[model samples]
Target: MSSPVPPQHARPKRAMAVVWASAAFVAVSAAVIIVHLAGAPSGAVEPSSYAASNAAPGAPQTVAVGPSSSPAAKPSATSPSAAVTKTAAAPPQEPPKAGWIPVDQAAWQAQVAAFKARKIDPVPAGVGNLPEFRADCQYSHRLADDPIVFPDMPGASHMHSFVGNKAVDAHTKAGDLTKFTATTCKPVVDHSAYWVPTLYDAASGKPVETTGFRVYYRSVRNNSTGIMPIPTGLRMIAGDAKKKVPTPRGAQGQFYCAFYGPGDLDGIARSTNGNWPICGGDATLHFMLQFPDCWDGKHLDSPNHKDHVAYGSDKGCPADHPVRIPALTFDIQYGVKGTTQGYYLSSDTTGRSASSMHGDAFLMWDSDAMNKRTKDCIAQRRTCDNNGYLH
Candidate 1:
């Protein structure tokens, strides 16, 4: 009993030791749990990985596409609903073909504006000592859904739209075609037929149309080029029928443009199929083809239609094609409000090639008109039209 009384202070020390041992065991267990979590499989995660903040919320997330120069593709709240929404960077304009001119956008626009502003009356004013004679022809019909060279065959030739002469067909003759017939041209003297490709809707696989069409025949010569009539049986091709002939930039005779729509005049500017303005909407795509002024009297048609005809220069006609005639011009207009899918040429029978993209003219002028044109208007070097004598 005396020994127990003496050990009272010692009892407190033993109890304190037990408490320290329990605290150490609990600390070891917590560290093991931390290590286990750090090396755990995919599902387990450490608490430190995420923020445990109880503060206010921050900014929202945003996605930036590229460097600052290029704008974001999405349309803004204030932008036009019909505007072309940029989805990606635009590809560079195609490289101009060799010997081909590039399209001069600004110059083209200015020229188009000027043409639109021109005041052309049904009757024209004449110049003193110069009789004005022009063949202002409008759109009429398909010259040949088949070609004159190969008629009655489905796949042999390209399709062409014809105007001026009403009797044109796959086997029309100069003598017969020249017979006096009603025409869409002014002065009623132009019985000759003009032809080009007919436009088809790129989307619906149907035909497209034009409300306006006019062609002008004139002398655009620099030197005193002698004038002559288009030989009785002349058959020729203008523009490239085979090659992807690149038109030179700023050239007047051959041109490309957008009209009567949005900025692209509402047509396709760069289409997948290389049509400059791929029309998916309300704009119209246009092309103007100018023909040669010099000719070789002996040959009416060439194996290559272009070989017999030559363009005039400042000096005069070339030796090969010396007979000069008024340069033929086809001002073609099409109503194609298209989209960006692609476009097909009126002459395009083969979907893969632009070889069919061409124009053709068959010489069948009314005898009186031809005679008067060669003698008075062309021979006199005066500018003329179907409306009346114009300077």
Candidate 2:
């Protein structure tokens, strides 16, 4: 080396060039390895078998690579994200349908025809059971067509009574007649204070006597058609002193008068035994205009009348006394099986009032007849009888 003591400048320049070349080679090798591990670009590097060199103490560090670095090492459809997508895309199911049908018209007409074949009868002349009155009775197509026609009746002028007894004019004077008569009348022959009589007295105007007339009646209507039967009842009351009478209670009064008829049948007087007016005094007679049957068997012993009326001579009459009668009508129709529900007569299209009156004064069917009708109705599907007691 001493013998070759060439120029100092040339020696230093050679050493510098070598150092620069070494640094470039190290940087290039590092870039090649990094590119290979990252899935080398198409023209970046060639596949080769070589071991990586050790980095210098102060050289930059890098992450190590393994066989898992291959591009095909991706997740499959069984992944969590895929499962969530499938679940979100699914839809819910629906429920099944139900079937129903409407009632037929021909069936209803047939029922009406059958009812016409089995007609109703008029009320009897004396006190007795309702079923027995059917022997001598006439049938009418409709309530309006009934032969019994009321005169001087409150709602008769307004055509209210024609519909039923609901539309009676409450503001008129005749209207009061119906109200006073319907009240204070007892429907049953009970020995209670519910039955009050009428008499003229010297003081306190006209006082109602404890013992009087006992009347019972029943009426019915079809809510769907507005058709109904005549109202009817039987009357039993104390007689006057002008004739000899019998009293079970041994009271001073006698039992002379007794009469029964339809709503239009008026001026019914007792002429056989003595001069006894069938319906007289300051009282006006009325039947159980309309009533509903107890389907639940709850009201087996209930009265047929809706309420009682007080007929006073002061309103516009010859007598100066107070009397009681039965008023109010109702419309009743078949309901659900085992149900006692029904409609009221006041709700009919005819309208209702205190003075309103009903047509066709025939007697109501007794318990036996009602039971038979109910059974037949159930068989025809016109009504429901759950207990089978109607049969």
Candidate 3:
């Protein structure tokens, strides 16, 4: 009977074989999982590595994770094992050299190249008649600092009222302004820093800070032709800080009265010293200072800080300062009404005259923005407000 077909038990043997095979597969999968857990890379960064330990108190806490903050870089296409090559960063720039310093050749060349490439647009039809653009700024801070005059020496200079760039300090340079983009001025692209000697209340001997400050960039001459943009890193001082002369009612560069409508620019009453104006009826103290509109096309600054610029004539700029630039005017208004007791300037503590009133401008701008405004508004002889828009 063919040995009774091996006792007819094939089903039991097949079941045992299937059980053994399933056990072996489970063991292999477990081994694989253990290996992966032991050898896999951990991508967690150390907590201290990303901490903003150096941030100042009350400042926004910011961590600099560098390029890794972006999407993870992919491997090189040419060689999968190789990392993607990073672009070399530009070299660190030096802090701008101040008095008696010449402009950096490379930086000047780059600015000139960009300025030359800028488009010179014609005056648009129905443009306003004023050849001016303005930067309206609020008072930023008060410090015993003058960056242009007393750089790198904190508290060495007299008290000054600063506007425009909020980061300006005694150690600040033109290049520093760009790095600190927080500013008090509108159209924040104008990173320029402006400062004037602090005004003081004569009666109380307390500070009298500016209530309103407007910086006007314009052409003094009727003809705006051949006007080049103000060079980057230019330092200018408008009035004579050392002057202590009497500013009578009709004296030039004297502080005058400015009101809304139908009022005399000269005040109705004079100070006890006849140096300052006592305004009446809805008027306050106002002072307007105009800077030179001509540049030498050479030095960024000189020992005197005034040699690199010159006043322009009705015809054009002088030969010495052949390059024509937009004149900067500080239209400052004080909130306190003038009194017969008068006011004192930080520069003229003894004399207490407005004659010593002066201003300093350290210019830094977004090159493209400045070029556009110069071409579209200033060169075109159009009036533009804080936003560089015609009213």
* Global Cα RMSD, each model: 36.5, 53.5, 31.1
Regions of model 3 farther than 4 Å from truth: 1-99, 120-125
TM-score of predicted structure 3: 0.73
**Highest lDDT scorer:** 3
TM-score of 1: 0.56
Which has the greatest TM-score? 3
Clash-forming residue pairs, model 3: none
Model with the higher lDDT, candidate 1 or 3: 3
Candidate ranking under lDDT, highest first, comes to 3, 1, 2
Candidate 2 regions exceeding 4 Å error are 1-204, 207-391
Residue-by-residue lDDT tens digits, candidate 3, 1-391: 1111110101122112111111111112222222322332111000111100001112222111111111233112122222232221221243245556687778777876887788766554544645667687777766566777766655556667887776676677666677666677777898898989888777766667777776778765657889888877889887787788888777655776655344555678888998888977766777766677888988888867888987775578788989888878776767766898888887787787888888999998787777777777678776666666453
lDDT of 1 by residue, 1-391 (tens): 0010110001112112111111111112222223332342111111111110000011121111111111242223233213121221211243112221122346434433443344443333433222224554555544223333443332233445566665555445455454435565555666666776655555554444444444445555433345555554566667554444322222222223433222332233555554444533333455545567677655666555566777665467888877677666554555544445444554443452333445677765654456555555545544444533433
Clash totals for all candidate models: 23, 25, 0
In candidate 1 the C-alpha lDDT for residue 53 amounts to: 6
**Poorest stretch of ten by lDDT in candidate 1:** 1-10
